[model samples]
Target: DAGVTQSPTHLIKTRGQQVTLRCSPKSGHDTVSWYQQALGQGPQFIFQYYEEEERQRGNFPDRFSGHQFPNYSSELNVNALLLGDSALYLCASSQMLAGGDEQYFGPGTRLTVT
Candidate 1:
């Protein structure tokens, strides 16, 4: 089965610009969650989507937002990105509802905001 995949394995951007990252969940999975991983830090949950609606979110700012589609794919959009936004953006998938089970992650889309 095809697992979760993210685009632009790596990315570079300016501090004030915006960026959008995409993800496709693993087959048979229905939920998608987005995470941000800074250097030497663990993945921090940004938000989660289920039934095409945002089900849960973490302590991120309003600049961090996401969307889920009917096909179970997802996207992460950051507005007025800051240098601190530079990190590995990971997308994880799960078969159950929010926090009900373990999630499988993608390789990640590395974003470098200068």
Candidate 2:
């Protein structure tokens, strides 16, 4: 299996700009999770998608949004981008097991806002 994959490997955006990143989950995975990782910081949970619905979200502003497709793929959309929004956007895929969710992360898309 391909584990997880992200697109546009790298990205650069200006302040107040809008950007979107894509992700494909591993085989047989139904849930997708998005995270933001700033330099020297741990990944911060952004949101999660299940059955194409936004199951959970983080403290990010409204500018940060996302969508999950029927094929189990996902996208992270950020509007009115800010300098503070520059970070490594990570995508994780996993299934909701009884024990817990063991997420597998993608390489991530680096978004830089000038």
Candidate 3:
């Protein structure tokens, strides 16, 4: 009965590096969404997953990728990290059938790319 959770609360990487952040959805949630929040800015949608398929994506480039597993857990992968990639990566869970109106958020993973 654990709620949404994310791992490696903080991470540091250099430019051109790659990193993967993981998330587990709350019980009963079938959809997972990823967002990136820059300092003093609102979270920007990265993508969403339902039934292990990427349902939607934002304006980010292909360097940003992700996957959803059968158990509803998800991962966000970013490649060729740039300094601009530094941000707090947030993960949220919701029931796709509920119109995803209510989301349970996980403590974000802070990523810093030098």
Best by lDDT: 3
Cα error, candidate 2, residue 113 (Å):
0.4
Global lDDT scores for all candidate models: 0.94, 0.92, 0.97
Q: Write the per-residue lDDT of candidate 3 for residues 5-102, one digit (tens) a residue.
A: 99889999999999999999999999999999999999999999999999999999999999999999999999999999999999999998988999
The reply for model 1, stretches above 4 Å from the true place, is 97-99
Please report the TM-score between candidate 1 and the true structure: 0.96
Better of 2 and 3 by lDDT: 3
Cα-based RMSD of the predictions, in order? Answer: 1.4, 1.1, 0.6
For model 2, name the residue pairs that clash: none
What's the number of clashes in each of the models? Answer: 0, 0, 0
The TM-score values for the models, in the order shown, are 0.96, 0.96, 0.98
Positional deviation of residue 55's Cα in model 3 after best superposition, in angstroms: 0.5
- Model 2, residue 61: C-alpha shift (Å): 0.7
How much is the lDDT of residue 81 in candidate 3?
97
